[model samples]
Target: VPRDIASRQAKNMCDEGRGVGPAIKERDPNGNERMMRRGVYLDFSEAIGRLGRDAVSARYGNLFEMYQRITGDDPYEVPMRIYPAVHYTMGGLWVDYDLESNVPGLYIAGEANFSDHGANRLGASALMQGLADGYFVLPDTMNDYLADMLRLGKVDPNAPEIAEAKRSVEERVARLMALRGSRSVDDFHMALGRIMWEYCGMERRDAGLRDAIKQIRALKEEFWRDARITGQADELNQALEKAGRLLDFFELAELMCIDALHRRESCGGHFRAESQTPEGEALRHDDEFLYVAAWEWGGENRPPILHKEDLVYKDIELKQRSYK
Candidate 1:
């Protein structure tokens, strides 16, 4: 994911170099050329720019040499190409400000909860956010929840609901193992990845997305029907575990694409081909679309509920982002 972002930034910097001059590209005696690529590095573009021109030049020169040896190309003179690779899921199980999910007993934090970092995330902020939540927010908030639970007395784990849930999980796993299908789990996972990368990748169009949606649905059907597992339910089966996670990823991929499609304007990572400003900057419809979109699960192949949390920007005025 870092490499992908770096490449994209490099490409953008190359573009900037084009506008400014040839100072973006420099060469050593070994014919190994290097160029200062631009994009968000360590999630801070301005800081990277402020690193001093000579420093930037030297750093990128070495990087470009490494990239040339690996890819057999001088990225300094040309754009370093990049496309989105699944890094981390910023959107996931919805949670409240206290990081409590709709399921009363469940509390989600870290990358699992869609707590902070609305729409586009900032670099270095993720670490800060995670630390803040884990070290500070969670401890205080969980104390309150625990206190409330204490007031209500101890809850029994042997309740019918808990037993039923366990039974359902066991049965589901047993059923999956019993299927004895012909295709391996990895086969379906790779197929899902291909479908996701093709349609719901960095760029998106309506027709392509619709086609991708159909393909993903078909793939999901194939996964349930034809996927083969090779281990018992009683033991640790890495294959089975991976299969479950991949299945979840497949479902989540659809939501991501749908969310990206619904968001008409190009902002941060969620870029839509149909929307862009005249200057090629991400055209944010702040007045109409500055809201965090939270999607609720609506079963398989059905559209999810669209919940919006309005964003009120006070310090930073919504402006077209410029790297130049």
Candidate 2:
């Protein structure tokens, strides 16, 4: 999810760099390959709902009654269901106001840096945030960092640590491709997505979440054992590409569940079935649980350390959020 957002933000950055054009082009300052614009943003809820309504009307021949019964409102007079999709991630690597991550040399901008949105992101603000960070924030911040690097001289990429990391990644990729197994990588990925969407989706409960954890563990074990690949590690293999992403998704899914589990109270997107008011709205326990639960990666299937970042409310009063 983080990688997807980063890629999108990078594409948007590249687009903004190249003035108004049919195809975005990036000029490589260094010898490194320039990134390009790519990615499709689809709102599934709207698309699926439209398809469902159309199919139901075509099949049953009673659109009005079905719509009224399902929504308890007139279709012509009311707007359809339009909840926020997974969309873009708001929280990411902790950064200062200057868009510099905790790491000095490495700078994070756009969706990769958690600065703009507090809890819930506002509509149309994503583009604004991305543009602002890339065009305005990163330029100045990166310039400062670069200036410092110039003064200190460029760090050697041949350093033992860097070399070791690269070698490790290469070996991991090679191992994945070398695997002689039955099930395709896509099969494992699709299964993982289905499990995640079913369990850690919009609505969540303790029992369901617990069950999901066990199920995901079993799936991951199956993935490691039964996963297959038909291409060499060095080649441009789409299957291998997807497998890497799926691996990341599997790790991220567990984190999402852990974050959701720790956050007992419902707030914004983090809805808990156990935590709701008598009126059926989200019940926030501000006194006891008013902090963002940030998780640090432990290991494969191991629980992460829960670090709380206190949410201080000043402009917006701490009141019950409602939509009726």
Candidate 3:
């Protein structure tokens, strides 16, 4: 089975209240420790017996060691308790053919840019993407922008626009530092993670997504009101950095939910509950949603604007994927 299918199946079992093994405990965003269901079983005992422990150890010695270290379970004798978690970020900031974003002079490359993968990225593709983008694509394309920049002369650091940008950063940092609340940044982060994973993880529905947006907004408000940062802006503060990043994470989470709400069809890793076949297979609607949803941020008060980039295939034809 594909990674997406495996994840969906695991989540399905958990959702249906048939999850096995001891409940794994983790701290939720609300500062409470919750026991999450583990629905997947990874049995290595049969493999260990068939291939011999030495052969299996030779193949996955490091992984086995790491797993044992974390869980204190011996895979050689017992089946490993497992569940799918987030591995890679398939999509990121939108970029053009030259790897340039809408903002001039900013060139995005590798995992930071959304170009190569569509809805889902296969295993080991991130490495291939990083190597291609870093070694080949950005090197050649960045030169085009650099040459243009050279023609325009040097930019002044003391410019009004530059000063305003600097001021904005300082102000934001000051606001973060000024928080005297009892809750740590991690509290808010954990809460936000819970919201996203619950509503927008393996599968999604209209009601859940709408409810998620509201919950996320409420949490974001709570974060702004109560999040505590320990250090000043001038010093190297990991907590402050986390606080800032968590703010962005909140925004990104909302955007993801909004995007999920808009695209009602199940495609790639995004499995909409309302858009599946009788056999529980993902149904892709190629006619209505065969374009890239390039969302433009519409400020704090307004909703985001969706810009569609139609996908055109000349050499290859688009077809529904089957894992039957």
Off by over 4 Å in 2: 1-90, 154-157, 299-301
Clash totals for all models, in order? 3, 0, 2
Off by over 4 Å in 1: 1-57, 61-88, 152-157
Clashing pairs in 2: none
Candidates, ranked, TM-score: 3, 1, 2
State residue 36's C-alpha deviation in candidate 3, in Å: 3.6
Which of 1 and 2 is ahead in TM-score?
1
For candidate 1, lDDT tens digit of each residue in 1-324? 334334444444544653222344533212246674333222224534578546756767677577678767556445544322455445557788888888885888766666675333455666666777899888988888888788887667998989999998888788678757898988777777766655666556787787777777777787788888898778999878887787788778788878877887877766566776554555677767888888888986677889998878889877776656
Residue 278, model 2: Cα distance from true site in angstroms: 2.6
Candidate number achieving the greatest TM-score relative to the actual structure: 3
Q: Positional deviation of 210 in candidate 2, in angstroms?
A: 1.6
Candidate 3 per-residue lDDT, tens place, 1-324, comes to: 666777788877875757787777876444577676766687887888789999999999898888899989887777777777976555778898888899997888767777885345665676677788889888899998888878888889999999999999989988888998889998788788888888898889999999999989898898878878897678899999999899889889999999999999998778899998876778989889988899999998689999998988889988777777
Q: What is the C-alpha lDDT of each candidate?
A: 0.68, 0.67, 0.83
Error of 1 at 164 (Å): 1.3
lDDT of 2 by residue, 54-104 (tens): 664566447556756886965544443322235444466667788776567
Q: Write down the TM-score of every candidate.
A: 0.74, 0.70, 0.87
Per lDDT, the best of the predicted structures is 3
